[model samples]
Target: MNVKGLDYTCLTLSIIGAINWGLIGIFRFDLVAFLFGDMSWLSRIIYTLVGLSGLYLISTYGRICQVDDAR
Candidate 1:
């Protein structure tokens, strides 16, 4: 089965955001913030990207999970 390119990109970004949050919970470190500097515009942009990526996942979750489409 071939997944759409956009779906793959969104899924990859979602996984990245999830892992970043997981690290934050366990280590009190935000990787994106650390690299971009907290409170900086770059940091905010990273946060926003992650948030939007998550929202995209929520919106598309059902559509992506249709069993018939997987085959």
Candidate 2:
């Protein structure tokens, strides 16, 4: 597996999740819910994917940071 590509994907999803959280915190808006309906199956899938991506990033963070620090 190409970890580089997977890392990018995870980072992107995590960023999207973060932005959604920020919107909810500042404006009480839920973009996923707005797009897919509250607690709907599709929205739940999206939420799950975003959460999984965040978890993946957490696992890879230390390695990623070490690589950056080496440069």
Candidate 3:
């Protein structure tokens, strides 16, 4: 149940990203772009950061699952 701090942070960001996507699909709202201003450099930076967080989660989950399978 215990996760590393970085892992936890990445997971939290990933959840935020997912919720934003849900809103976009269901309500046509882009939360990140709205909060940061669409097409602006700041918004783009946030988008990139969120994407990196998701990638981190993917790699972390893969490593954790591999360890569990080895046990």
Cα misplacement distance, residue 48 of candidate 3 (Å): 0.4
- What are the RMSD figures for all models against the true structure? 3.6, 1.9, 3.1
**Pairwise lDDT winner, candidates 1 and 3:** 3
lDDT of each: 0.79, 0.93, 0.87
Writing each residue's lDDT as its tens digit, candidate 1 over 1-71 gives 35577667777877888888899999988888788888699878777877787777785768757865888
Query: Distance from true position, residue 46, model 2, in Å?
Result: 0.6
> Predicted candidate 3: what Cα RMSD to the true structure?
3.1
Candidate 1: deviation at residue 27, Å?
Answer: 1.0
Q: Residue 29 in model 3: shift from native, Å?
A: 0.5
How many angstroms is residue 53 displaced in model 2 relative to the true structure, after the best TM-score fit?
A: 0.6
TM-score of every prediction relative to native = 0.72, 0.85, 0.80
Cα lDDT tens digits, model 2, 1-71, are 59889999988988999999999999999999999999999999989999999899887879978999999
lDDT of 2: 0.93
Q: What's the lDDT of the predicted structure labeled candidate 1? A: 0.79
* Candidate number that wins on lDDT, 2 or 3: 2
lDDT of 3 by residue, 3-71 (tens): 688888888888888999999999999998898898799988877878999887878768989999999
- The CA lDDT at 62 in model 1 is 84
